[model samples]
Target: MGESFPMKSGDDSHSYSKNSLYQKLASDTVKEMIQESVIKYLDTDKVTSSMGSTTIALADFGCSIGPNTFLAVQNLIQPLQTKNLEFQVFFNDHFSNDFNTLLTSLPPERPYHAAAVGGSFYGRLFPRNSLTIAYSSQSLHWLSKPPQGVNNEAGIHGSGAPEPVARAYSAQFEADLGCFLDARAEEIVSGGLMFLVMPATPDGLTQTELSALFDFYGYSLMDLADKGVVEKSRIEEFNLPIHIPRLGEMREVIEKNGCFRIERMELTNPKSKVAGPLDAANVVTHMRSAMEGVFAAHFGASVADQMFDNVVPMTPRIADCFKALHHISNQLFVVLTRK
Candidate 1:
């Protein structure tokens, strides 16, 4: 799962950077979750000498770009700074990530010194017992690749999948998540804390409007394939590397790992409503930004653009994106303590 999906770049039209603006609401939700957890940790628990030396080592895995990452780090640092603590923050992503934008735009002075570490969170990146606090937001749902042997013609649309296909996806998710826990367990100290904010589905709701939206895009690809713009097999091979987990599924993975205790878990959203099509366009751009790189890498940029352009008017069904602050959708937050 070391494959890279760089956010759409360039200053034209809509790119991953622009698409990520919609995630601000989601960012705020996670930032607050981290802040509260930080407060709770400070109240009752204290880190050992190895865990909390003079500097608190923090890492935010899958940190995309500026503004949001900046805000998240700032939120985490403010509470620590008040307690006379310093930080060594590491911003991590895949190797092909836009580290330049994130590194260059960092503030002239801040509470923490920042560095970039490139790798997949599904494997170990840091030394044993190094990270005092670890975080990953909107990143875990991505499987290393589409499930092997599954015929997901409609990509990740749970509604479009047959029983076997869904089972294959679930198996892949379990394997990926297991690897994530094993990696993080080695990186974080015994008493360290971790904050995970991931996309989720409610129990029994296999598909959300987001999944439906992706399903529609898969259908659109078939439409293009019918005209010979792209091969039908291309669509079949191009599944989004995502699997939206349910809250219970999340809990099961954490508990099964045995290295971490679930201190808190919540399923809620920002409840912010997107105004209209422009905001809805953010949804399209967000997905495009995430999937375009893979599409272009596998096919060609021309095909990626052609298919993306065909869906220009693709606003999500609702005002707010399901991944965003939409009231109806479930945004999952899990706070864990390494035991």
Candidate 2:
């Protein structure tokens, strides 16, 4: 199974809390869309009636240590609050996530009962039919584990992998997402809402800027192996736990799961507040914040540090690779309702 790797913890320069601007931009981009979806598809009256209560129970899956998670929760809650209903908000992530940072950083005077639930969302975390809403942003692309039968010669990321390797990644994603929907189907009450947002490709699109970023990293590792700084066998054994699904793949998984009805699905282009493409330093920092733990776990911390430090100065094309990062419509946003 693909192990759960938590985002880099703490509030320092390399922390996920500080480096997750792209995710924040995504949440901001979808804020209005989420509100509109809530008003349009969230059956608050039905939720209350089905659950025999006024306190609506909601959970944010894969909620890493963040201000982004808080923003997303508030956006979802605001639409429901207009109806004057009570809420019990659950913040969930892998067991190793920094709950201390996540919980303490919550807005003071926030109106709602709050608690943290730690576990993989691929399995059941709550009692059956107990939740009124489920939300996950920038989370679902992570498979429960790296796929079996993939090796270094196939490349590191699904976007740049060979055909057979890409198929392996897709198969793993389908299975993982199936488990996720099954768990949610059991936990969520009828008429509850589920909203998902993550990076994904549209049908027939072969490459994305995100893919190029990973391919760049793969090349860096290869260069390191050539210099005898890292073993070639190590690269062969490693695969990133991320899979960017195409639109059709997502629809297929939801359909196969037979749990929820898809209400809205589309691709969105998030506009960054910053003026230009991220410089090599910021780009590397952002990638490290989310992925350093994974790399450290695969390679030792010292080796991982050397690899990243070497990547910037050795590769001048990194900046050009990410130039159109924000301009592309790579994000998948979908709203579903429990049947």
Candidate 3:
């Protein structure tokens, strides 16, 4: 397993808490599915009876600093609340994550007792069969670490990466996702429900629009390299620690793990009317919030800041690349039952 890399922290303009509307939109697209799945598949009676406890434990794995996590937790607990059960909600992520921001920004009238668990979700974070529900949104795509010894000189993601690099990413995701499933299997009670939402494709292939975005990002970084602002070797050495899994790949992993039975799964567009278009500015902000940590780690923070700052003025030139992405269905939503 690799180490944990968290999203950008704090409440600043570029912070994940402020710029994670993209993830929030993805979460919203599956809100109804989560609620309905809980109602139909979650055996609350069985969990309470088996544990002999009314306090239902729920966990949000990879929950970054957020208002989004708060919304997701509420949705998952809403159905259980009708049963008059007490709730313990665990907000989990990397130890470096901004738990202070998450804890302080929590809804004042929230119904459950909340605690922060610091660590990677690719491993167990709770005692065996202690959770009644497990949820992760826009998070699982991130690998425990970038694939070792893969030279992805083309782009940061698998979109335009070389064959070896792409395979490495896919293989790492398969293993990391396996670890995640195995851990969640031990954590969730029998008949418990797990909901996941993340950026994924039909065949684990990179979408054309996403490829274009990656290319644009590559262009921006190479331009910096040309200006001697950052090393070309560093650019080539850097690959984003994320993998968008194919539906078939996900199915294979779930079945192979033999711990959770797939209840429902679907691919959908995360586009939203309220969220507006996938314009250049929106893309830049979302990428910065999500990737700044990775970038800052590879390059210095000052260099990362300079690179993103330079991209802002060039948005007019790159606006075309980010357009038309709204028509693509790139979000994967899944519901699982702990067997």
Candidate 4:
């Protein structure tokens, strides 16, 4: 997974920078929900002794750039600070993620000792029985690579695809997630917790708002191809290396993997909409920050730039496309415990 699916290269110009858009809009809800989960699931002394130690091991698997990672770590450890627990916090991401930015911006007063492990979450990055709590958010839907030769140029939703393409994506996710569970099962202590927050896809493999964003995203690139901004073949070959799954699919992966039991599963309300203009701009910057580097890496820098250039004028239309996405909920939050 690390070799195949590294994030778009980590550079400030072509990189995922610390953006206020995501910090203000995306992080708070996750912080609150994850905190609530910690309050309920983090039985410090018992969990600590479950591993025969008073040191609590916690990690954020896809710790993206900036204050959100800072915010999330703070939220997780601050609550535990009142309790008697020493912590070894590991911030893990692909080698391409901006760890320098993350380490530099650590809270002036951190609650726990922090370190970073650079690798993909789909493989082993920690030793056996090492971690007590692990969390991943707004990630996990990304497959290790795009479905080989599978095309969904007309629509972004896998449900809308024909048999072969849909099957390919599904199989890819199953394999990636299976690796994720198997790896974590080896790393986490018995009865440890993993809190996952993923974008919710609607049931029956149909298109949801989350997928529709890709719809518009793909369309813009395809349009650029028409205008000769990018080679049509490049657009044809490109597929977002991401998929959002229904809750059942996620749960099934966990059950089939045979290492963890589901403790809680939740689908939160649709993503909150800010005012129209800010919502539109925020929408563009948010998507660009997370995806631009990846797109550049997969496609070329010039083609990806042309694609996003086509995307800007269409930004406001994102509002309507987003409104069209009335899926199960905004984000899905799930809690899993080692069995």
TM-score for each of the candidates: 0.91, 0.96, 0.94, 0.89
Best by lDDT: 2
lDDT of 1 by residue, 1-339 (tens): 647777765444565656676566677867766787888874323664655476788899888766577777788777777675678899998888888877877888788889999988888999998888888877888788777776755564545577777778778899999999999999988888888887788777766656666665765677778989998787777666778887888888778888998889887664443443335565676778767887788669998788777776555443443443344556788888988
lDDT of all predictions? 0.75, 0.86, 0.83, 0.72
Q: Which is the leading candidate under TM-score?
A: 2
Write one digit per residue (lDDT tens) for candidate 4, span 66-125. Answer: 566677677777767777778888999888676887788777777678898888888999
Steric clash pairs (candidate 4): 159-205, 209-325
Q: What is the alpha-carbon lDDT for the whole of candidate 1?
A: 0.75
TM-score (C-alpha, index-matched) for candidate 2: 0.96
lDDT of 2 by residue, 1-339 (tens): 457899999999889999998899889988999999999988788888878899999899999999899899899999877686998999999999999999999999886889999999999999999998899999999889888878657456835577888888899999999999999999999989999999998788756656777777777788888999889999999988889999999999999898899999998977455577656677677878898888789988987887778777744577776575557678899999999
Ranking of models by lDDT:
2, 3, 1, 4
After superposing candidate 2, which stretches have Cα over 4 Å from the reference? 272-274, 278-280, 314-316, 324-326
